[model samples]
Target: MPVSDLTAALADVRALLLAPDDLVRAVAAGRRRGVEPPAAERVEVRPVALRAGPHLQLVSRTGPVVSTVNAPLGERAAAAVDDLLAQPFGNFHVETSSQVLQLRVTKRGEAQVHRSATSRRAVQAGPQAHDRTKQRLVDPDDPLFRVLGAGGDKRRQVDAFVRQLAPLAPRALDAAAGRELRAVDLGCGNAYLTFAAHRWLAGRAGEDGAALRTVGVDVRPDVVERSERLAGEAGLAGLSFAVGSIVDADPFDGAAPDVVLALHACDTATDDALARAVRWGSPVVLAAPCCHRDVQRQIAGARAGDGLGGGRGGAGEPLVRHPILRERFADVLTDALRALVLQVLGYRVEVVEFVDSRHTPRNALLRAVRTGGPRPEHLAELDALRAQWGVEPVLARRLAPQLDAVRALA
Candidate 1:
């Protein structure tokens, strides 16, 4: 429990890193004693083969995005492990061929060490960049999949969608800090993600005996009715749906949701969902934008204006010179602005590819958690981007009230 005890536990973890041949995996998760949480919420390291010989691959997840770095086995990898241990992570777990070692950092900064024998095998005899095979989180044969009429490509899609959320959902609930989790899915077409999210989250909540409630909102009455019927057939509790557009949905009935999801909401509909989330002060928000037509139109209209590779042939003009390229450029610019807007409006945001393009071309997901107001640099960058593009994002406009409030304080 003393400082020396914590140091001893860390030494054990570091020693394991040195023995790469026996190391299966190491993970550091949760937050410990700190005024500010670590930059990455979770960090994992595993043994891998590189041309030079054995190496350790470190994968760090800050929010939705993950960054990977490789260090050669031995001192370098041990140093990397030391850096990770320095962070205020509550749990440090190591798995090896012979034993599992877990070092837990209590809230009072006491160190608790637990060791147990394991039948788990060590690193395989070759360079493995990825898992040989992964167990599917959403099995194709799941009854919920059957209830949703998902099979073949549809089932694969549902599985991928849930895979994207797996890493972030638990953290989102943690942000609730043991309170009941209330979620709302905007523009939930047929409520595939709505159903899946609720089921997954409910299971998680059940683990801790925490309550969870989720609702799906869409504009089509028939879709809502079908979703409701499907929910009934699946026999899931605390899930419901409402018929209304993302812009007009009052599905929460004035209660702000803890987690907000807007998956593949078309064009500015994504903006509408985001605007609502910001206004409601939702703790966590995830949106996958589809169709950049709004920004595309703005870019086209501004082509003849200044600073846009105006017909005068500015450097930026070439990117928007071709219609197809312009469309793609708009897609990038649109999401960038949306992310920046959230950053400016007191949310920590990350833009990442939630799923592979093969599953869905519209796979860019914006994952955010409300943190606090924007720093001066973010505001300056937003202004510069708006000035250069000569286009105000629909999200920026829709979020005027909140944005204005933040700017006023700044």
Candidate 2:
């Protein structure tokens, strides 16, 4: 069929589905050959059953004709309609199964095809597509965009990061001491993530009456000043910036923080942020480590001599097999150890990709939400693992006071 014709037909089908009674009346009228029926002779049209498969069948009975119309569309006719709307223009097969309708489109001139699925009653578009299509008022001349936007590439990356973090904001707020929550962002460089987090939390607050206050901390005085100015321009109240290193700044000294965020904190700075979050007993902590200095140093030292003894091997065998490979391996090992430590300390930890690696090589996000007191065995295992590795986890050392020996045993 012609694309225009198909489009019109799909629209008609959608309209028909939306107003079944009107569809029945139209179908009944179409069946009648223009002869006016007597008042008592007017027939009632009632739908018997509508079934969807490779074809759509609408069974209805009227006066003379027990009519059944078949459209070569799946049972999930509404989903088929959605699929048709999503594409620019193409030949597509729509399959319906209970609540889901799958759409597969084949281009006319190309061998390649595209496929997508939608719930029969899904109201919103998928997260990926929704996020991508969302328009942000980020003009090139805009000072805020100039500082925060790292071109289109970095802006997309920032969006993805914000979307990933968006889901955890509510849970974090729920765990806060009160309806009003506070968050601190360590090493908030350009404050892209910082702003995104604030916006997201603000949206959540609007929806649930959970007010949030956010403070962005960076070592660079100029960046902090710029960030504060940007926040003011954006009209985002309860969000501010400060110039300080994570190690020196006590964000929760006077008032406790509900969440702590440190995205792409360099080397030991990520450790410092995590340590501060733990010490403050912040319910939620999200960090993406940019470098692995501690582990790299350990790997370098190991290369000079032998590996640390533990876990199915002795000190003689090389821990990472090769020097270059060991450095890379240490990065993964470092993040893994951080996650394990978080888990041991009674936090539910998730290690997942926060954004595309092309945007930033440090794409991994460590999402740790404090659940309860640490189990006794968890503490013992943490100690044992630290001993086995012969390297202290900086986060573990900093939050030692909060680490309960009895709870670890329990």
Q: Which candidate is the best by TM-score?
A: 1
Candidate 1 residue-wise lDDT, 51-139, digit = tens: 78878888998755789989887688778878887887777768676676767665556676657665323334223535633334465
Cand. 1 Cα-lDDT = 0.78
Q: What lDDT would each prediction earn against the true structure?
A: 0.78, 0.59
Model 2's lDDT to the true fold?
0.59
Instruction: Give the alpha carbon lDDT tens digit for every residue of 225-309 in model 2.
Output: 8888888887888899988888887765676688899999988789888887776778878898898888777655654443456
Clash-forming residue pairs, model 1:
346-372
TM-score of 1: 0.82
TM-score (C-alpha) between model 2 and the true structure: 0.63
**Each model's TM-score?**
0.82, 0.63
The candidate that achieves the highest lDDT relative to the unseen native structure: 1
Off by over 4 Å in 2: 1-147, 303-306, 310-321, 380-384, 404-410
